[model samples]
Target: MQCPRCHNLMVEQSFEDLRDDTGSLCFKGWRCITCGEVLDPLILSNRAAHREPMSGRARQKRSFIQIGS
Candidate 1:
């Protein structure tokens, strides 16, 4: 994904918890490498459901969520 603010290429990266949260999701986030914009993979998964399933991406996304929970 490209950064909305700066039109920079985004990269996938992971981060460990910096602060304690009792019940927060602890997954890593995708961010713009140059502009520092955050992207939510979960939101992408939800949006993918609206499109026609031509590839395995949507199915894979659904399976990932089910496995996560």
Candidate 2:
């Protein structure tokens, strides 16, 4: 597949640790040789799952305050 960033050919490669958080992270993903862009589906889904949902009422109050000021 072509890279979204550089539009170059993406090569399938295995990596050790992309994030390098705590333990070793081993996953196979597509890598762009031209711009060094990595696309990993697992990481994307993991991030979405780990994302915090915003508080509705608090957010609304903050928005009102900002608008008034």
Candidate 3:
């Protein structure tokens, strides 16, 4: 992938513990080495149904917490 801001190539990386009150999934985060932009693969897919494309670095650092039923 390419960084939307700098147009630099992005590097793929794994991120663990991505969840909330609604549960989560093991996802990947892409980061642009040039502009420090981070994109969450999961969020992009989920929001694609309703929202516009996601952009820029990770504004909120999100992590998953196992939910106990």
Best candidate according to TM-score = 3
In model 1, which runs have C-alpha deviations exceeding 4 angstroms? 18-25, 41-69
- lDDT by residue (1-69, candidate 2, tens digit) is 889889999999987874646777878889999999888878668867886557876898899999999
Q: After superposition, how far is residue 59 of candidate 2 from its true place, in Å?
A: 15
lDDT, candidate 1, 1-69, per-residue tens: 677789989887775454566655567668888968777766568767776666778788999999999
What tens-digit string does per-residue lDDT give for candidate 3 at 19-51? 677576667799889988888866677767766
State, as a TM-score between 0 and 1, how close model 2 is to the true structure.
0.49
Candidate 3 regions off by >4 Å? 18-25, 52-69
TM-score order of candidates, best first?
A: 3, 2, 1
- In candidate 1, position 46 carries an lDDT of 75
Task: Give one clash count per candidate, in the order shown.
Answer: 0, 0, 3
Q: What is the C-alpha lDDT of each candidate?
A: 0.75, 0.85, 0.72
Candidate 1 weakest ten by summed lDDT: 16-25
